[model samples]
Target: MTLAPTRIEATPERAPDMRLYESLVARVSRPARYSGGELHSVTKAWDAHEVRVALAYPDLYDLGMANLGLMILYDIVNRRDDALAERVFSPWTDLEALLREHGEPLRSLETRHAVRDFDVLGVTLQYEACYTNVLNLLDLGGIAVRTADRAPEDTIVIAGGSGALSPEPLAPFIDAFVLGEGEEVMREVVDVVRAWKRDREAGGLPRIELHRRLAGVPGVYVPSVYAVDYHEDGRVREVRPLDGAAPGRVTRRVVESLEPPLTKPIVPFMEVVHDRATIEIQRGCTQGCRFCQAGMIYRPTRERSVDEVVRAAGELLDNTGYDELSLMSLSTTDHREIVPMVNALMDAYGDRGLKISIPSTRVDSFSVEVADAVARGKKHTLTLAPEAGSQRLRNTINKLVSEENILTAAENAFSNGWTSVKMYFMVGQPTETDFDVEEIVRVASAVKQIGRQHIGGRARVRVSTSNFIPKAHTPYQWVGQADPATLRRRHQILREGCRRAGVQFTWEEPEKSLLEAVLSRGDRRVAEVIESAWRGGAKFDSWSEHHDWSVWQASFEEHGVDPAFYAYRTRDLWETLPWAHIHGGTEPSYLRGEWMKTLNEEITLDCKRDPCNVCGMQTLDGDCRHKIAELVQMKVDGDSTQKERLMQERERLMMLPVISAP
Candidate 1:
């Protein structure tokens, strides 16, 4: 039975008084963030679009404005004639207090529409620390904080990102989660909501009806219909669906190719974290880094052709009038035609004083050469990720970079006129020892010595270490994170050693790492603790000035929850995890095998060059057939000589480093 579409009466919402808003903005810091009339921002008529979406990033505008994922979705939604998307972000403490005092609700940037009037409120969960801000933003927007309290006419809340893999912790708040990449799935979501709104207006359907319908959509996980059973030991025994509409396991959505790049992104009024025109040159990485969640989830490596990237770069620069452009990817230097692509970009735009940068790259001399080609003599600080201290630890984590690779890369950078080098490492990884921890300092000191050879007293080396957190959907998911005391001890070692060696050093806050672990690996029961924390004024936990550990501790105590149970407990091999049902291409068995390999310090080869390692994508959609064929054709076309030479050189330059413990 085909039902005719019904036009629902839009809710009446009062726009904020410009005079009052202007007065309030004048008093706050960075008022330009709220005064939004940026270039290229679309503000469609309110009555024209059938569906309105408020895309929010639960952080300050400075950082959220630079998020490529949010921008991509914004461009996608606004391109549709029947729909329009607006932007919102978590207000700073000063602004939040002011809004509360004035009884003003959070408003969208484009049209100043009250967020409550939108049909759907989509929040991107980029990191776990932003969880409290999600609740605060909803409350400040005049929406119910909990999904269960929302009425039929209230805006439906949905979330997506890498953090959506473990949806249990946020199940009570978010109505639905879009697992994996949201490029294609977002449109389907809009269609579903459009239809549900029509049906609800026609017959006054209940809120659960909308959830039931959304559950049928591919890649959407409606948490209310799912029930989790816990074991006697507080571990998750199973997560079964109550409604037949819900799938037993929600497989991640994958797009065959990355097309329709956002060429005309909105230029922010204020400076953002990354204030440059950017193009995603590719998606996914094939390097099997055991401790890396992004490497595990975003599999089967897809690339944008060199022509497409170059074309996109030109369009982006022209549209935004920005002097700099960035080719973004998980591994920017790993692109097959990176050399020719960089050369093409330099040839075309280098004369225009356009600066190009690659954010993420491998630790090798080849990466140095690519940087050199892009920079063309304007040398700056180069960032590299060694990940671990010693070669043995690197092997265990499948970093695949040797000691020679590190020294040679630094040497090449120094020789190429670069003045400073920044290295990133991780502490408290599985099987980490005191000797391994001290090696990080040794490596940094060695790089400083090498740098002095070229630019004495002018060369600088900085080492930044982050406490390792075991994330969901990775090989380290079952491993226990080191306690705060142990991590602090390791930090002390790094601090004293770097001080003695005349090297700059910094480290992440251990408590923040603990909170990240608890939230990332937590289950549904932890939702109570989250709410409690928010009630006790816990927002912006990512910022050190705003994060109050005592508040989190009080909330945990009030809710009768132990943070250590989630952060520092190693699960048995046969145990079911909180996110077992949220499958992201890789199977649990494959991850388990990888974990076993990590224990034995075994290395898994990258499937991009070698044969398939069977990382559980074979039985699923969007496997690595195209990537494999491309690599094979490159070899057949005689492009493997350079790769062979690099491999042989790595073998010849292999040497042990002599160093004393700090």
Candidate 2:
């Protein structure tokens, strides 16, 4: 349903400190960030709504406004009459300093209300770097960073997004974590708050009771309600629910049909990270990349019909007046009818001066064809993510695509109108070596030659490499990441090779990867590390200028928890994973099998064309794409009887016995 715009006014009590706002607005780099006016900004009378949510994105305004998840939840929450949602982004350094100087609490853009006044403060945990920023957001908004310290009057602090998949690191800070899609669960949260507000107004509702009520919500994980025991070896031993009303394992929420994947998102006044209309044509990936957490967490790939896509695109264009539209998906080219969808969009919008872009295109000629069909040889720069440099390493990580595929795709693009091809690569994979790192330059040099042959001297080959950090729910979760010495050595190899080959090379700082690993795989004990680092002046860590490695180093030392234990120590198969209680559609046994496949140099075919090779999505809802391909000529991943027994045993087995270890 298309929601109508409403004007929400700030009550006298909800109004922000105008004097503080006016004084600081002129001093910040972007004065517009402090201003509340924007096109299609919704507002309602503050007291009229039972619950007001200050949806905080723990990043700068420019980046936060571009988040599709933030925008999706913002729209969803505000659509309800009983609840209202407002946008709040972490202030830039200058504004943050000024706010502190003036003793003014952070406020929302719509109602200009102090962030603490909101009934719920829903923060988006999109990245590990945002952990410290979440603490900064809480402290700046007049709320305690720790859940235990927060008073009943404080806004309820809850978080969601990919970072929440393994939420142990931030468990002590957040009141609750939404395990999966927030479309339904966020509304449920608001409903609970609306009822509690009524009960609270009548008298006093115990804070513990309010949290108990929330624990009953599906996919809502109240860390306080669950007990986690750690072994002497620093590994998780068990996680048990306290009341039994809460589930021992919380299943992630998924939307079965992606009918309209959020088309008409809000438009930002100033430039943002991705300034365009976006349509999520598909939801999940079936590529089964061993190191990819998104692939494992979001399964049972669902695609929006081409007709529905066209309709959504048209409506978005008509409503937002945006000229650029991009198709979003885990693997955009793998969509069943991508070429036809691109061609239809181009045909429909060619005369209207539309710019079409697709992200996460596969490293194959078919992707080149789709790009050509959409942009009509007008686009100059084409991007591809090979992930690994060599085909062997690629196969080890289950990257499926070959060196030939990458070269052929570049050839196709160069033959069409692209002058430069940007490639993405990672060095710290599970089974990477010096040879593999050097091969990156070989591939880049080859692509440069192809571009030179096709475009004649205007060819450009640019490569960016970063270290891979193992994440929860992925097959690589049990493995440790590369240490600083190894990571830097690999980066140096790629950099020197690219230099010798005359290819432009860029690489991330090795320390960032180490910190990311610590944050990604950490348990509740690491929560102290996060807070200490933030208190020691660590914010905007994703930015190079603001990154202080010493802060993280100090925090790790203060907590007496070696960062290496979380990031560099390999795990035994039977060892309890910190995120064991967070089930993401697939069985741990299945993940163990996939992890073994990476070691055995075995590859599973894409279920779209070949047999089903069931990855547990079939058990979640239905077979991978039942509506389009309905013959049911699908095959399970393992022996049929074994798969059946494992499926039956999944319920009884809390920690599925790992079949093998790498």
Candidate 3:
């Protein structure tokens, strides 16, 4: 039998003095966002381990705990007897001001120990918007924001995740960036730290020597050992290795298979986003959405077998007692044996009242069956991401889903007891036009009509559109983002169209999206902008209530960096991106080809079901070409006829009339 998980409560013994932290909490808007005392939290004895590492998420506790990467590393590090890992998150604005007033530094939730006191600080760099928060955390921890200003005795700061895959923007702040998955690399790093601590205690070696040793680890990039060069145009020329160190290119690490992550996810005391249990049914995506950085960064799709998924769900249910389990993936329906997997889960736990959720379903009619099986009698909202309104613009970005299919999917969902439907689209994709925007309204109206006809008087249809931001390492990376004025105009058009069509429309602020674009595509020089922003009173930019655009504008001016240069200027395909030093499996040549294809309005077919186009993933893995080839063959043979049938069925489905049920 498996061992029961150890639970740690947040009591006075473990919680820090309220007076010490109260001042910091007062300055932050959300005080509870920082306080750790959530149910199912793990707190190990510090004395039991020689090395203690704090895995920090530079966001709020609620958002941080939901990340799968943090949970995976937490499980892997704590499973070892010699290493102890705890969690920390940036305190909300309310808590931050109170702590600053009292002159108290950031402390860990498990032990309330100063973050600077930990042996190592491993941060998960998930997004570019959190860059300012990273610098703020370092200052709060009493550490120098810049690596050069720190001494050898200071805690080693390391970062990993999708953001680190292109570490150029944050190169100056972090000592070293761990590329790709941390499950395997983290153990090696912890072991190195353990050995170094032992040597320090015994007077066997100097601390600087230990730092050098740690830098030699594979997949670790030490900024101090590399020199950056720039061309007259202010583009990166090269990132050359200093001395006899390894080349500047740091390869990402990938585990052959995924271990059951977060067998015991912390149960928050208060309501938070994604509060339910989550099981990552698969890693990576094969659909190859052209504008998505996640699709590019996390390459070579890998899925947990049905048995592993069911076992994980069972363990999560047994431990956390969560009513719903979300099967997470870039696209859950794309899993090869999705039907069998869902069936196995239902067979094992359906009688026990367990409901499985596929959060990232494809926008097709087949998804209706998957939803029906998992939901049973429970009514839930069905979401479809058509991405664009017009098929011509969709083909330009390689989002090949047709408007007819999306409507058909909605009809199936509404007919099967889904009372509400949500449709997702982006307004500022490459080659998007006023006609495309109008098409979005048309498609949404059609979907609403289908919902009313199928589900009658009790149903509603909602459409959500977000401003598009071009990101690094994707086909659209070189494309410019829509300026605020253009976005606002487009938003107004969408609102008027939706209102006329009697469809509820919601959209993210165009200004926030513009800021995200500035940060996302920014270079190393933009770090100064981030520092300035934080100093000028910018925290939690991800949250609308906390974000201050005025602060960011001032920071850009203070740093002498034009945000428009990064966010609104298109680049040549041959020009170097700021994150060119980090390799995200796929080759630059492949991405360039995809970019050219997009210009010609060519649809690069999905590799999941087509012949290997030599997209560079196979070359990165060296020997995994056979596996990739097999999967490609499976995709081609498995979906060709089905795709043809879907096209015909979609046309027939779209002809249905829209009427209100009385």
Candidate closest to the true structure, highest lDDT: 1
Q: Is candidate 1 or candidate 3 better by TM-score?
A: 1
The prediction achieving the highest TM-score against the true structure is 1
Candidates sorted by TM-score, descending order?
A: 1, 2, 3
lDDT of 3 by residue, 521-547 (tens): 777788788877888878778878888
Colliding residue pairs in candidate 2 = 7-43, 8-43, 8-44
| TM-score computed on alpha carbons, candidate 2 | 0.92
Clashes of each: 0, 3, 18
Return the TM-score for candidate 3, rounded to 2 decimals. Answer: 0.90
Residues 1-662 of candidate 1 have per-residue lDDT tens digits of 12222122254232545466567767999988877668777777777889999999999999999899998998889889889888999888888889899998888877778789899999999999999999999999889989999999999999999989988989999999999889899999999989988999999999999999989998899999999999988999999999999999998888878876798788887898889989888899878889889999988788888888888777777778888998899999999999999998888777888899899979999999998988888998989999998988987888888888899999999988999999999999999998998999999999999999989999999998999999998999999999989998999999999998888999998889999999999999999999999999999999989999999999999988999999999988778999988888888898998898777776766777555667777655455665445556666776666456545543443422221111
The C-alpha stretches of model 2 lying farther than 4 A from their native spots are 1-16, 623-662
Q: Is candidate 1 or candidate 2 better by lDDT?
A: 1
The order of the candidates by lDDT, greatest first, is 1, 2, 3
State the C-alpha lDDT per candidate.
0.87, 0.82, 0.77
- Tell me the deviation in Å of residue 15 in model 3: 10
Ten contiguous residues minimizing lDDT sum, candidate 3: 653-662
**Could you tell me the C-alpha RMSD of candidate 1 in Å?**
6.1
